[model samples]
Target: MSGPITLRTQKALVTRYKNSLATAIVQGASVLANEESPKMLAIEATALRETAALVEKALENFTKTADGMEEITEEQDKQIQAYVEEVQAVVANAETLLIRIGAKRTGLQEATPMDEGRRPTVTKKTIVELPEIPIPTFDGKITDSENFWALFDASVHSQDLTGLQKFNYLLKALKGSAREAIKRYPITEANYAAAVELLHSKFGDKDKLIRSLQTRKETASARNSQLTEQRRLLDYLFALVTQLEQNGIVLNGSFVAQKILAKFQPDLQRRLLKQRVVQGNSEELWAVKQLLTDLDTLIKTEEQVSEMLPENEAFRGGTKGRPPPRRYETTSGQRSQMRQNLCIYCSDTEHNSLRCPKVDSARNRREFLKEHKLCINCGKPNHISRECLRSGCTLCDGDKHHFSLCPKRLPTALSSAGPTKSAYTKSSRTTQQPKRADAKQPTSSAKTGAHCINSENK
Candidate 1:
């Protein structure tokens, strides 16, 4: 009709029985050896017999109940087995003590019943001391409250403390509003549970706690402050995630990764997204670590570049909201200098090489040739000047006189315009004069012609 005994209850009962039996046996042995009176020895032996009977009855009940129980878990089975072994060992010791004290065995079997010379020696057990639990303290601050409650709750549940003891420890950890809230309650074991319930009712608002973890946004100004906003955002997110987890809101790695990425600016988000794509199936923790590392490296590189540049040139290109001033003074000075050194052919300083004039002339000449189709030598398009094979005076294209002796070769505008007309007149005049006079006149004309030709060449 009765339910199965819990491991805790069974262990407690077994421990108590062992302690009582050991105490009674030690007392009986001490009285029998030290006391000269048979009356005292008999009285101690009687007490020992009663204690042994109690232990034996309890062991019998435990064994019957443990054996009858079905559907026992491994942990329960181990507990029951350990309890039985301990009880049996205690009973054996009690029997040996009874035999030594010259008392009758209380319905318990002994291994060496006939050997009365074999005496049992009690060995002192080595007690292992456990380390003390550290108590957490909490102020009214939300951050402190969260950390303290987690540790405090774990410690209270794990330790074998009474209700009053738990309440006292809780009070010792509280401060400010939390401590004040429960101060009016009487400090009694009966009121401990009520006090805890009242404290929770007063302060525990899940919605408010959840709302406190609102997403924080970084400002544009904060960007110039060397990642101050980013650091703040990261800390807030980590705390928010931890708080959410504590509240039993389980989030997956991808979901957390998305949440973290969402908090970043558009540029940073895009960069991190690209990185994630490259990495392929990275977890939230790894993504965050890699993101932070990249940001740090980028910041360091920028700082190094900025350091390398001259202070005046470092911020020369103004940022988004502002435009750099136009440097008119330096620009105007450079323009004036360029104008002074401008090319004679093109009237531009951009062209300073010998090829520039040649290129300009060739382009113009080609255009002219294409339009008029004229040759430089005979005013005909049959061939170019270089391929002209007509046999005549080299200077004027005349057969009457050699090119050097041509009288029309003068440094005059008319000569430059049309030398053929002047050549005809000079040739006719040379023919009309006498041969003797003509020879003398031709010498002066020849010298004059040579001088004019040299001047034209220059």
Candidate 2:
């Protein structure tokens, strides 16, 4: 007597009931947009999907039911069909409509298309932006490292500089030169006093050190000084790190420097607090220095054993530009090739004599002469003498013997007939001077003329 009772039928019936309930809930919740926690805004989505599936199932069942229920109540069947249609329409329309309303109501901004087709909407969805804290960056390192020591390797590699101080001055220049580039003004090896005048001009009279203190008091009273000083402190930290990094102390110096700064700041603040009560120079460099120790002490490491010397660190690349380790053992052939590649003995493009496996070992064979103590010019080994081919004579251990017995040093009759030293000097001095001078003048004049033309063009 229970109509079509089965688990399948019960499940369908439950699904139908759920679909109806979901639709009711969505319609009811739609009015609660004003209520916070905004639950209704999301429910509409679930109702729409459920309602679509329910309508499809309801239609299919209605088709099957009609075949069996022609004998049942016609009015009831029509009512069920109308209800399903209405629910379907409601779900379909409400889904699109509510979503559009929610998008507009929640302050979702619409974007204008820059060109052509349908534009994507751009809305400032409320995002949590964390408070910004400045950080030291690697780029600042490159700009601050202009000192001669920093630039020394580059200069030597390029053959640019001639002196060491010039190299140092160049590095010192990095602080001032990279002022705007660094977050904090560089604490240069720069004469701090001289920079004050410059900073005064650059930062304005308000930017001057002494003037800034008085203003800082006023700003602090007004609550702006708190912000400004914090900014200044941050800037100081950034600049300090930047300078250290340029000097090749990126990892080590920045950490230790920060530690010392942490130690120094509270003391500095107290000193400034005292200065606030007293009247003094608008700019305070001495008090700053007194509160802050010379960076020289900072140069010594934590152990105080040895300091970080710039030269100790590899200038161009890591520790040494030692290429990556070789995978295979070098063969004898490779060693020979390396020797050939690095030949430095002579201008001979043919072969390297220094490490050549084969060399001219005839008479003055270099290795034989060097080992056996023979003269290099004539080259007979073991006797230590130079032998000349022309005279066919061999002397032991020296070159003067060759000069003494030479077949090539005979005098000619014309050579003998030539003028004596005194007569020759008298004639040569009088005649050669004017002619040589005359010969030199035209060529020198031509060179001067060419120089003038080039200079004029420039």
Candidate 3:
């Protein structure tokens, strides 16, 4: 009973595959008979191959399902075998059709010599010639050995060349003591290996190179701890650590890390420590690694921020739209006696504005400033006192003016009331403090005397 039911299901699966294969074989055969073009034949051939694959898969499923069955009558076994043979026959037909289509495609491709009634395509390719790599010359300096060998190896030594050719190349790339070391060996095929080995021992010794790298790191310094200097120091340390690690020397110890750390300023050292410790990395090796990684991030960020700023941004401590007044120098490097601009007070170019002898009195200075439209405080043109960004007058602690132009620095005869105790004045003055602005008025006699002195000064 189970044999009949199991064989029935297997027969149904194989029957579907047999029908699919048969239908595909008919379609392929029709296309092969009607079409002589390779493209059309190829499309039918692909379809036949897919159908054949499906039929084979179904046959596998049928065999697997029958083997798992517990019992099968002799009649059912014959039926299963018949179904398998039917599916196999359809798959065979499909395969034979595919072969015929392939043969047809080959014949058509050979007969036409060109595809789709068009002339054969002549693809033009632009072959770019590359520049030849020049062999690197070495001057026998231990510091330059690594770079020299790296270039020579890539350009000449490791290329497809005979030993004699390589030997000649090595000769051309050597100079000074480097050429001298290999000069004894005659230029021959057999001496190339010996020469290379000798040079490696003298200059490229692993221990010697490692020791050189250590010396470089030990002597490295960034005293100012400026961003550019710090970046340079970081680059050297990064290269040193990489070279050491490549040579199988690890910087797990604090000796090298501490030495490198000592090269930076105290503030930078504290920053490195704080950043590393903040990330919970207390290991010395981790600190060194963190320092390199952090510096890379710091340098990149600084460069990015710098690139985003406008090129015309004014510098601090400088006047906008105009350069600060500067003394001129002669072609012979001697200081010239002339000022950059004519003095507004004395109208002479020989002396600076502040040092003008004729503009001695504060009243005259104020008159000159107003006439020239200069700032009353700093006495510079192009901006008023309120717009001045310069530091205040040191003599009076006044933010509105330069120290030399301060009224308080002038003689007391310039004003009868003396310097007022304004908010702009510094608190450190020991001179007598004048009455507040809101204080009771001075006596009529005192006011009259003040007016008389002011008139005499004018």
If scored against the real structure, what TM-score would every candidate get? 0.32, 0.18, 0.41
* Model 2 agreement with the true structure over 1-458: per-residue lDDT tens digits: 22333323643663575567556556645543453333454465455546544554454454454435435467865655455445434444443444444543354223323467743433233322334322221222322223332343343324332222222222233343334432132222233334334433543332233333333322331111122233344445445444444444433333333343443334334444355448453333333232233322322222143223332231111112235777887998987786454422222334332222222212223433355453444332222333222223343333333221222321232133343222112234344321111233457889999999999999
User: Taking the tens digit of each residue's C-alpha lDDT, what string does model 3 give over 121-238?
Assistant: 4211112224557668898988688888889889877876567557656766788899889755644468799999999999888788889887887787763323456677788788
Give the winner by lDDT: 3
RMSD of each: 38.1, 35.4, 32.2
The Cα local distance difference test for each model comes to 0.53, 0.38, 0.64
User: How does model 1 score by TM-score?
Assistant: 0.32
Deviating ranges (above 4 Å) for candidate 2 = 1-32, 35-44, 67-73, 89-458
Clashes of each: 0, 11, 0
C-alpha positional error of residue 202 in candidate 2 after TM-score superposition, expressed in Å: 86
Candidate ordering by TM-score (highest first) = 3, 1, 2
What's the residue-level lDDT of 281 in candidate 1? 57
Pairs of residues clashing in candidate 3:
none
lDDT of 1 at 321: 29
Which of the two, 1 or 3, has more lDDT?
Answer: 3
